[model samples]
Target: MKSTLKKLLPFAVVGVMSGATTVGALQYFNHDSNNTDQSYFTKASNVSFAGMNSAAVGDDFVKAAKTTVPAVVTIKNYQSRTSSRASEQDMLDFFFGDPFGGKGQQRQRQQQTPDNMPSGMGSGVIISPDGYIISNNHVVAGANKLEVVLSNKKSYIATLIGTDPNTDISLLKIEEKGLPYLNFANSDNIEVGQWVLAVGNPLGLNSTVTAGIVSAKGRGIGILGSQGKAANPIESFIQTDAAINPGNSGGALVNTNGDLIGINSAIQSTTGYYQGYGFAVPANLARKIVEDIKNFGIVQRGFLGVTSLDLSDDQLVAAYNKQKNTNIKAGSGIYVTGFGESSGAEDAGLKLGDVITKIDNIAITDFADLSMAVGSKRPGDKVQVTYSRNGKDATTTVTLRDQKGGTATRTKADLSVTEKIGAEFQSIDDKTKAYYGVNSGAVAKNVMEGSEMAKAGIVDGYIITEINGKPVNSQKDVENLLNKFSGTVQIKYLDDYGRGYQRGFKMP
Candidate 1:
């Protein structure tokens, strides 16, 4: 009886062990990381995973995307691109020899083949409900016609209102109402590493949204003056890495709340594609330009009227110190080299030797910083200027003046054009004339589309010194002379490179 009991006990113990193993296997198989679902080990074990670091929850940009995507748009620019140019023919003659021989030459001069249609595309941000859109100047600069398409697939013909090349911003209107627009955010409040979204028609893909963080602030890429678009340009770009491509120009870069912080302008890449770096014009400055264009028909720029030298420029520092008996070098902020005629600097009692330390409360770290601060000001605005004279800090209030050195606003409207001259002009300013060593000339500001200037291969930044071998001083002089003169008219002009050239255009 004792032997039989022992055998039964061994079998019972084995059965109990088998049952425990099966339960453990089931628990391991159904293991879940959710707090609600836990195994015996997870509940009973004293082990902790708290020492392991976990990422903080990030913002879900869904709401921002929904709010912004509707306001962003695609801008299509259509230009009547005449492929047949005299220079192209000349280049053909030089490289491959004229295909039509000398026969094509006479016809090419007398008649232009205006069939090939050239077009460009970019993005834009609708700022107002009544159809005011902000975009990069290069996007719609020479477009004969502009077409705007919304995210909802609605299309409208956009009118070219005005452009400010200095800031690389252009204002357009679509004559439509009830448009969803994005409000401007305080760009100064945007911090690096803050979440940002770029919404636009990148690569012609409509309503594309990309997310990133603000990589930098107050970045100057120097695309303005060098491009022959503007003389004194201001570029304090908010740099980001939200994958801005070819068609992303003029798109909206918004904060997490979907507020427009900037208008995407340019990309810094050698391959012409997004290699991480993207730039945008600050919303504050852009808004100012839009209001100026809407009210004044042109940007009312405030001129400090001084040829200031950036201390960050090593060559400029060397030249200045050598030319003038003084110890000047980098990190001196901005030093006044000379004064303009009744300029803001002169009015504020700023001297040539003064080193600008700050503007208002913002520090002037460099020229780009100074440009950003002053570039946002209007002609009549008063700003508190801070400087250092002989290493002593000083402050003064300056009444900003226009480029013409006065408070009176300069209007570009109502200037009637006779015939299709295809360009706008102004008598070269004294500063510009002295720089180019030219006595009298009219500087071509806007070279219009399908005009005689465009046909004659004249471009912006060309200084027209003489017409038919006679000096033309102002816009009136140009119109008066062109009105009276007939047949082939020879225009002597100085290119931005200071090289002189002659171009002939026939007018009946």
Candidate 2:
């Protein structure tokens, strides 16, 4: 027998266990009919509930689990046999902690099965009475079909509404109405040691409930960054000691009153099984993402447009002070490193050596605090930023902007197919087209990280001559060709070095 153990990274092996499954490339869908009102979930109090401070704080696990179990459903991921093989490679990379891992060895665990059979299983929480469900993006990323199974064993085919890779949340909908759902609790009010329940279908067990306490909050475990944009992964996980296992990915983390406080996401384990640590996405941030996807067809994330160094690291602070000949103290707050293009922080008079202390009166002691504060807002939303410069406190109101530095709120209709695919194109020059021996071509000007194009290995400077067998000479041509495609789309392109290649990705 061969040993299956692989080298684990030093940063605590994190397993995205969706119940012994294979994840695939993500496909996004934006349909007008699937859009719903933003007021689907009932809001809970931001302050403590009526019996939060009572002596019997954790004695009502039975009631809480009973109320929430019906709302938590099992999600099955079904992928066609013909989808790109890249998803298999990605899954291997996710499990083994290697980009090019498991290439030579054939996958022996997953045997060939019918396309109708589910390839993976996880859990989801119903947020609306009309069959709207919320689950982790990894749970249903590469599925050709999705099925939602209720606690009563009733199954319904689900439609993918929208997804936010940055937050690792995806929304699904069924045609049924008058379904049981969970209310959203203000996760910001949750404290350490508070009683909570993890309701999900873990290890193929349906309607399993586990009790635990909030061990920590605002934990950045570097989990979402592996699946999302490395530079902009919004990970302020609610750390809990719940026994969340493989099938609990998108399940509900509820309070004693059955109010949803977070979504169980990842577990810190080396064997891909639940150990002692589990993480959940706070309900406050998840609610914002759900509302954005429901109303705007995409997340309205705001960016402060400046990178910073954590002042908590004494050595890093000392090195920076020595390099710059400045007496910067090591303490709370993040020291500004640089500004992004068209930065709102720069426009608001924030400079590189300034230390950000607060955002909208909320304390910003580290990147987790800063990420949660800004990641929950929309573009054009203004935040009062308090910072320290030369040991003097100053305040400035920053008008937050989008990734492109725009302040306007954009809807799904505002984005072209090329943008949705995660890239922008520019018409190739006549000389360039002649050199490539093509009559018409377009160069990928900008490629968004963690996008379909990026997943398909498309990068900046790649010249695309055809999309879905149609000639693409300009940006408009690319969009027109892609818009007409529904399912897998094939592309004929040349890399930045003029090497020819072909790729395919699914679209809906």
Q: Return the top candidate by TM-score.
A: 2
Give a tens-digit lDDT track for model 2, residues 154-256: 9999999987777878899998889999999999999999889999987666898877789899987766665334347888999887677677889999999
Residue 304 lDDT, candidate 2, scale 0-100: 95
TM-score of 2: 0.74
TM-score per prediction, in order, is: 0.71, 0.74
Error of 2 at 332 (Å): 2.3
Q: What is the lDDT of residue 487 in candidate 1?
A: 88
Q: Each prediction's Cα lDDT score?
A: 0.75, 0.78
Clashes of 1: 0
